[model samples]
Target: MKLLKEMIHPELATRTGRILRRHAARGIVLREQDQILLLFTERYNDFSLPGGGIGEDEDMELALVRELEEETGARDIQVKAHWGYIEEYRPYWKPDYDLMHMTSHFFVCDIAPELAEVRMESYEVANGMRPVWVSIKAALDHNLQVMSRQEETMGLSIQRETFILEKISREIIF
Candidate 1:
């Protein structure tokens, strides 16, 4: 995978400590026109890609497929391309590490016409995470709105999601 972008938290720029690393695989499931699959997190008033952290010793593509199924109830998922990756260095929320580094791999994928009930985790359910096929611009605009307001409900993933949404808007072919 190629490095699409790298972002470093301002707080981590001059600070140093034990940095824990994590990896995630995200998918871009595009339909005809502007529709794209995404997770609409109501609690945060934001949207994110349908994917999650890669398990230890798991293949990235497999992780993407599994996550898509779990998060979006996607069927017949097929990863067609290694889109790119984004790297993020931020302050860790855990006590064990002072900072964290994460790489988010992205892939373009295809899914069957039908979907089933999502099997999201409890936290995701509590957070009102639901799978939806939304206009790429709608998700992006909504995320940008929440970000601009600096809402406390906004999650850290919103920024990354917004970035990818913008990229998709620009690069997605008609």
Candidate 2:
């Protein structure tokens, strides 16, 4: 999230001007044996990556680890590489409020294949955040819906599903 505060829109003075502080978030594009980790969020019942907003002044790397643990209970993750960033301009949802811009930091992580036997948090489980492994290509081909247009842009644009698929092709034994 620290990386996001550095990005600015041409029109607005800054996120500070709107009284909305910057939020940093991290998502690990977990891959194993040619399969990408995905979650079927109960809220909208859609498949998406695992991540959440970073608290004020929170360390993004720490936040990423915490979010991954909270959402999927996967430990001992090895961050393989950084996939860079994506920016979106809108509140996560609830269109009535002032729009927010989010900068998402994405990383490619390696997780134990056995962690697929997940322990979903009750909060998230109640809301439908279930772990699923899908082929990199399959995840891209599905009718994926991010929380919002901005969120979709923030997630999908970082690696673009095509690029991720290519990388997955060489790394995992599909």
Which structure among the candidates has the greatest lDDT? 1
**Tens digits of per-residue lDDT for model 1, 11-42:** 57544688888999999999887999999988
What are the lDDT scores of the predictions, listed in order? 0.90, 0.56
Worst 10 residues of 2 by lDDT: 1-10
Q: Which lDDT tens digits does candidate 2 get at residues 102-126? A: 6667766766556634555578777
Alpha-carbon deviation at 105 in model 2, angstroms: 0.5
Clash pairs (backbone) in predicted model 1: none
Worst 10 residues of 1 by lDDT: 8-17
**What's the TM-score of each model vs. the native?**
0.95, 0.63
**Best of the candidates, TM-score:** 1
Model 2 misplaced stretches (Cα beyond 4 Å): 1-22, 91-96, 116-123, 144-174
